[model samples]
Target chain A: MNLALVFDLLLALMLLWSAWRALAAPNATRAVVMFIVFGLFLTLAWGRLDAPDIALAEAAIGAGLTGALLLDAVRTLGESAGADAGGARSPWRWPVLAFSPLLAVILVVAVLEAPQQLVDLPAVVERNMGLSGVTHPVTAVLLNFRGYDTLLEVAVLLAALFGLLALAQGAASAATRESFLLHTLARLATPPMIVVAGYLLWAGAHQPGGAFQAAAVLAAAAVLLHLAGLLPAWVAPGRLLRLGLAGGLLVFLAVAILPLAHAPLLTYPPAWAGALILLVETALTVSLGLVLAGLFLFLSGRSLRDEETR
Target chain B: MRVAPVLRRTLAFALLWWVLVEGSSVSWGIGLASVGLATFASLRLWPPAHWRISYAGVAAFAGWFLLESAKGAVQVAALAFQRRPDLAPRIIEISLALPAGAATVLIVNVLNLLPGTMCTDVEGKILRVHVLDGRLPVVEEVRAAEARIARMLGVTQ
Candidate 1:
C-alpha cells in the first residue's frame, strides 16, 4: 500500500489501541490520560479525512476541555484505586462482551453497504451555498441549514452549567497559590488568544472556523487566567454573568423567531442573511465561551461535602 | 508619557492581527477592532513595567540557550547509555538576582527545558532547582542563564 494508506491504517490502529487503553486502564487518572490521547488521535483522523472544522473542534473540545473536565472529575471523585476496586465488578460485563462482536459486525456491514443507499449530503449542502449566509459549507450547515441543532446544543450546554452551579456548594478553593510564571504567561499569551478567537469568528464565514471553535479558544484563555490566579472562580452568577451565560441562546432565538411571523423558523431573508448569521455567531461565541469556561469554573468551587452527601 | 504603553501595545496587537489574518485587506476592519480590544485587555491584565527588552541581547541569549540545550541533551544521552551511570541528583536552593517579573519567569522556564536542571519551585527570590548530577556546576549554569535573561530584559544586577 502507498504511504498515505499506511498512515491512515496506522492512525486507525492507534485510535483502537488508545480507546482500549482508556477503557481498560488500571486507574482513573491513567484512563483519563489515555482518553485524551484517543481524542487527539481522533482529531488527526478527522484531519486525514479532510475535515479541518471537525479536527479543530475535536482538538479544542474533545481532547483539551474534556480531558481537563475528566481530570478534575477524577480528582474530585477521589478514585485513585485500581479497576478491580472500582467499576470492574459491574454485572453487565458478560452480556456486553458477548453481544459486542455481533454488534461490531453489523455496524461494519451497515457502513460498507450504506454508500449506495445514502444521499450525497455534501452535494446537497453545496447546492444551497448561495442561499445560506456563509460560504463555508460546514458553517452554512451549522448556523443556517441546521440552526435548530446549534440552538439545542447551546441550550444543553446552559442546562449543564445550571446543573453544575446547583451541585456546587462552596466558594473557590482558597485562591490558588499564585505562580508568577503562569501570571507572566497569561499576561503575554491572552492578547494573542483573544485576537485569534476573533479571527476564528471572522473566518467562519469563509473557512473552517465558527462560533464553537472561537468560544473554545476564549474559554481556554479564561482557564489560563484562573490557573494563573489572575481571575478567581465564580462564587455565583451575577447580573452580567447571567447575561453572558444565556445571551447567545437569547440572541439566536430572537433572530430565529424574528422571521417566524412571515416564514418558517430561522429562515433569514436573503438580503440580511449574512449579517444575521454573523450577529448570531458573535453572540454564540461570547455566550458559549462563558458557558464552556463556567463548566470548569463552577465546579472549581464545589465542596467535598456535596460529594459525601451524594 | 502615560499613553506610551497603550500606543506601543496597540501597535503590536495590530501587527499581530495582520500576521494572523495573513495581510488580507478585507479582514483589516475586524482586525482593527480586535486589535483594540486585545490591546485594552492586555493593558488591564498587565500595566506598564520598566523592563525594555533588547533584540540583540535576546538573539544572543537565544543562541546561548540553543547551544546549552544541545550540550545538555548530549550529556544526558551519554548518561542514559552508560550502565550504572554516576548519578548524584540533588536539589539546591539558590537566591535569584533577577526581579520577580518576566526575567525570573524566563529563567525558571528555561531551566526546565534544559537537560539536567529542573526548576521545581520558586519562592520569592529563592529558586529550588533539581539537577540530575550535582557535580556539573549546576548552580553556576543557573546563574549564567539568569544573567543572560537579565541582560536580555535590560535588567541590572
Candidate 2:
C-alpha cells in the first residue's frame, strides 16, 4: 500500500483505540483526555478524506470544547461527593467483550459496501451553486441551499445552551485558581492562535477554514484566557459583544427578507455580495463561539473570578 | 442607583431583542417601537439593576464549560455501559458562591439538565447533588464550579 494509505490506516486504528480507552477508562479525567486525543485523530482522518473543514470543526468543537466541558462536569460532580459512590462491579464483562467486536466488524462491513466515489460532482454542486450565492461549495450548501437546516442547527445550539443553563442554576461555583502553568501557556499561545483563527475565518471564503472553524479557535483562546484568570467573568458584555452575537442572524434575515426589495430572498446586491457573505460568515463564527461558551458557563453557574472563601 | 442599573439592564435586553427580531424589510419605526416596548416590559418584570451579567467572564467560561459538558456526556454514556460498579463516596451541601438572584436560579436549573447528576437544593452557595457513578474523585469538580461562579460575578482571584 502507498504511504498515505498506510498512514490513514494507522490513524484510524489510533482513533479507535483512543475512543475505546476514553469509554472504558476507570478514571473520568483520563477518559476525557483520551477523548480529546480521539478528536485530534479524527481531524487527521478528515484531512485524509479531503474534508479539512470538517476536520477543523471536529478538532475544535467536537474534541476540544466537548472535552473541556466534560472535565468541568466531572469536577462539579466530584465536589459534591468526596468520591464517586454509585459504581457497581459488573459480571457481564465477558459478554460485552464478545458482542462489541462483532458490532465493530458489522459496522466496518457496512462502510465497505457504501459507494466509494462521487459520480456527479459538477451537476450536483455546480448547478446548485448559483442559488447559494456563495463561491465555497460547503458554505453554499450550509448557508444557502440548506439554509433552513443551518438555521435549525443554530436554534438547537441555543436551546441546548438555555436548557443546560436552567439545570445548573443553583450549584455553587468552583473556586480553583488558574495554575501558573496554565497562565504561561495562555501567554505563549494567544497571539499565534488569534492570528491562525483569523486566517481560518478569512480563508473560508475559498478554502477549508470558515466561520465555524475560525470561531472555535478564537473561542479556544478565550477559554484559555478565562482559565488563566486573565479575563474576569463579571465584566458585562459591551455593545460590541451584543452586536457580534446577533450579526450573523441579522445578515441571514436581511437576505431572507430581500425578496421584497425587487429580487428573490437571499439575492444580494451584485457588487456587495461577496463582501456581505464574508461578513455574515465572520459574524456567525463569533456568535456560535459566544453562544456555545455562554451555555457552558451558565450551566456551571460560575463566574470567571476566583471566590474568596474555600 | 437602582433605577439606573435597571435602565441599563433593560437597554441591554432590548438591544438583544431588536437584533434577534428585526429583519431587512422591517420599518425603522417598527423596530424602534418594538425595542422600546420590550425594554419597558423587561424593566417591569425585574427592574434594570437586577439584570446582572459578567459578559467578559461568561464569554470565557462558556468556551471551557462547553468542552467540559461534551466530555461529561461521553463519560456518563460510557459508565452506563460499563460492566463494573465503582461506587466511591457521596456527600451533599448548599452552594455558597451563587448570589441570591436570577443568575443563581439559572445555575441550579442547569445542574439538573446535564447528565450524570441532579440538584437537590440551593440555599446560598451550598448545593446538593446526586451523581450516577460515585467512585471517582470529585474535589476538582466542586472547585471548578466555584471558579465558574467567581468568574460570572467578575470577582478577582
Candidate 3:
C-alpha cells in the first residue's frame, strides 16, 4: 500500500526473523549478535508506532547498551548459552512451536481491537503545557504530570548499580596502556560525544531525547573506553563515585518533597519550572551514566573496588 | 609547551552545552555548573598528560581513512551484489611496527572497519586480522594502513 505500511511490514518480518535466529543460533556470539539486531528492529517498530520517545530509548538502551553488555558478558564468560552450542535445539521447542500460533492469533486480535486514537492527552498537555516545565509533551508528562514515575525509574537505575556492585567480588589491575587506534578514536570521539550527550539532554526538553538516552550514549562511550583499556573502572574514587551514582535519586527526592507549598508534588512555579526540570534532568543524566557504566564495568569481570593504585 | 587538559576539556564542554541548548545563553548558569562537575569527574578518571595529538596529522589521517573506508565499503557492497562471491575468509596475524599505543589501536579499528577485513585481536605489536579475500595481499594492505597511521601519530618504530 503506502510507504509506511511497507516499512512496517519489513520491520515486522525482520523482527520475527531475528528473534527466531537469536533464539536458535548455533553459537553464543551469533545469538547475542542477532539479539542485538532484534532489539534494533524493535526500536524501528516502536518508531512505526509513532512513539519517538520509546523508539529512542529502545535504540539506545534496548539495542545499544544491551548489545554492549551481552558482548562483554560473552567475552568475559568466554562462551554463550551452551558449550559446543552448534546445532543445539531447545528442549521445549516443540511445545513452544505448538503454542506460538495461538499466541500470534491473540496478539493480532489485540492489535486489531486496540483503539487507534488516544484520549486527547496531547491537546490537554498542549493547553496546560505553559505551567509544565518543558515544551515537549512527553517531557511535561514525565517531569510534571507523572514525575513520580520518572523519579522511580531513575531510582531503579541507581538500585541496579548498587546491585551490580554488591555482586562483583574481584578487582583486576587497571590497564594503563591503550592501543594507538583506540586511544586516538576515544580522544577524538570524546569531544563530539560530550557535545551529543549535551545536545540530547537539552533537546529532550522539546523533542524525543531525554536524560535516559543521553546517559545511555555516555555509558556506551564509557564501555568502549573500558574495553579499550583507556578508562578502567577501578580508577574511580569511591566516595565521589557513590555520590554520583545516587545523586539522581537524592536530587529527585529532594525536589519532589521541597514543593509542599504547591498543590501537587513536583508542581513547580511556572516561571521556574523549566529551569528546575533542567536541573533534575542534568542530575539524572549524570547518575544514569555512572550507573549504567558501572554495570558494564561489573560485567567486564572487574569489580570496581573502593581503593586502587592508579 | 604546557597544557591544561582539564581546563581545555571544561571549555569544550561549554561549547557542547552551547550547541545543545540551541545557542541560547539563558541556561549558561546550569551549563557552567554541570560542566564543572562533569569536568572534575572526567579529570579525576582521565587526567592530563596522557595524549598529545597533532592536528595536522589527525586531519590528514581522517581524510585518508575516510577515503579508504569508502573504497572498502564500495568493494564489499559490490561483492555482496555479485552472483558468485569469493569468500575465502581466513584469519592472518601480522606484526605492527608501531608500538601498542594510539597508532596501533587506530590501525586495528580501521582495519576492522575496512572492507573484507576484520581485526579479531590485538596484543602488543601483533594483530590478528581476518580477511574475506584470502587471495588478495591483505597483509600488505594492513601493513600500509599501519604505516600511514604510524606516520600520522609520529610513532617511530
Candidate 4:
C-alpha cells in the first residue's frame, strides 16, 4: 500500500525480469548485457536490504568485473558459438522445466518452516566489538572472527590465477589498442583511483569498505589503463609479478602463523590487533588487485604459442 | 620533467587525497606516499604537452555545457512523446581544426554528452558523429564546440 513497498515490489519484479531476459536473450552480447543489468538490479536489492558492504562488493566484483570477463569471453569465443548455444535446446531442458517449480516450492516451504532466530548473532557481535579492534561489525567478522575464511578466499583466488596462468599461452607483451582520448583520460583518472583505493582501505576499519572493495577499485584502474592502451597485458609471472600475486596470502598466512606460536591461529595481540589488520588489508589490496587484473589480462591476449602449434 | 610541473601535479594529487580521506590527519602518512607514487606514475604515463589552460574559460564552458545538456535532454524527452516523431538519423563526418589531444578529447566527449548527437569514431583529424535528427546543424554545432574547447584550453588557432 505504501510507496516504499510499491518501490520494493517493482524492484523485485525488475530483478526477476532482467534475470529471465539474461537467460533467454538470443544474442550472446545482448545476453551478457542483460546479465550485467541483472547484477546491477541485484546490487540495488542488496542496498534495499541495508547491506551496503554487500552492495559495494556486488556492484564492483559481481557486476563490473564479472561483466567485463563475460564480455571478453563473448569476444574470444566468437558470436557464432554464442548463437549456436543460444538457439540449441538441450535434452535436459524439459526435465529442468518440470523440476524447477517443485524445487522452488520446497525452498519456500523450508524457508517458511525454519526458526526465525535461534541465536541473536548481531547482539553477540555487538557485545564483543570492543575486543575485535575494528569498529565495524562486518569488518570484525571478516578480518577477526572468521579470518580463516578470508585466508581460504585469498588462497582460492591464487589457485584460480595459477590455473589461468597454466592454461595461458599468451606472449609477455602485445600491441596495445590506441585511443588519444582514452589515453589522456586514463592518465587523468589513475591518480584519483589510487587515492580512492587508499581511502577505501583506511575506511574499512570503521566503515563499509575493506580489502576486497579496495582491491577491486585498484584492479579497475589497471583495467582502465589497459583499455586505454596504456598498460600492457600480462603473461607468465616473473619474480616481481610472482611476489605481487602471492604477497597478500603470504602476509596473511604469516600473520595467522605468528599467533600460532603462542595463541591459536589468526589471533593478534590486543595491542597490535588494529595495526596487524591494517597490514593484512594493505597486503591483500595489492595482491588481490594484481590477481583480479590478471584474471582479465591473461584471458584477453592472443597466444603466441597458437601460431607455432598451428 | 620540470620540477614546477612535478610539484604542481603532486599538489593536485595531494588535494585530491585530502578530499577523498575527508581531511583525516591519520591517513597523511600513507596519503603522502600515495600522492608521490601517483605523481610519478602520472609523469610516466602522460608526457608534457605544454598545455596552457584558462580557469575562467573552463568555468564558462562548463556553465554553457550544463545548460545545453539540460535543454537537449528536455528536447529529446519531448520528442519521445510526440504522436509522429520525425527522426532523421545519420552520421556526419567533419574535419576538426583542433589537433588530436586533450582538446579533441574534450570536443568528442562534449558531442557525445549532448543529446541528439553522439561521436561514433575519431580518425585522425576527422570526427564521425551520429545525429538523431539530420536536420539539426550538427556540423556547425560540433565546430562551435571545438572552438569553445580550443578557447578553454588556450589552444592556438
User: Which candidate has the highest lDDT of all?
Assistant: 1
Candidate 1, A89-203: lDDT as tens digits: 7898788889999999999999988767478898999999999978999999999999899989999999989998887775556447567887889888899989998898888
Ranked by TM-score, the better of candidates 2 and 3 is: 3
lDDT of 3 by residue, A184-270 (tens): 666556555656676678778888888888898888778767766777665343898889889888998888888877567777888
Residue range with the least summed lDDT across 10 consecutive positions in model 1 chain A: A79-88
Model 4 lDDT tens row, B53-149 = 8899999999999988997898788888899877899998999899777778888889888878888899988888899999977788887888888
lDDT order, best first, reads: 1, 4, 3, 2
> What TM-score would every model get versus the actual structure?
0.91, 0.56, 0.76, 0.92
lDDT of 3 by residue, B53-75 (tens): 67787898889888988988998
Ten consecutive residues with minimal summed lDDT in candidate 3 chain B? B43-52
Arranged by DockQ with the best first, the candidates are 1, 4, 3, 2
TM-score (chain A only) for the predictions, listed in order: 0.93, 0.79, 0.87, 0.94
Least accurate stretch of 10 residues (summed lDDT) in model 2 chain B?
A: B22-31
Better of 1 and 2 by lDDT: 1
Model 2, B80-156: lDDT tens digits are: 68798444436556445555554455555455544455666654556777766565444456556656766776553
By summed lDDT, which 10 consecutive residues of candidate 4 chain B come out lowest? B25-34
C-alpha lDDT (0 to 100) for residue A87 of candidate 3: 38
lDDT of 1 at A185: 91
lDDT at position A60, candidate 4 = 78
Q: Provide backbone clash counts, one per model.
A: 0, 93, 8, 0
Model 4 stretches astray by more than 4 angstroms: A80-89, A170-173, A302-310, B134-137
Model 4, A1-310: lDDT tens digits are 7999999999999999998888778878988898899999999999999998888878878754787788877766666556844434688877888999999999999999998898899999999888888898899999898999999999999999999888876564463777777788888888788877877888889889889988998888887887788777776679999999999999999999998878999988878888899899999999999999899877765545445566
Q: Of the candidates numbered 1 and 3, which has the greater TM-score value? A: 1
DockQ of 1: 0.71
Candidate 2 local lDDT, residue A276: 62
Which pairs clash inside model 3?
Answer: A179-B101, A180-B101, A180-B102, A180-B103, A180-B105, A181-B102, A181-B105, A181-B106
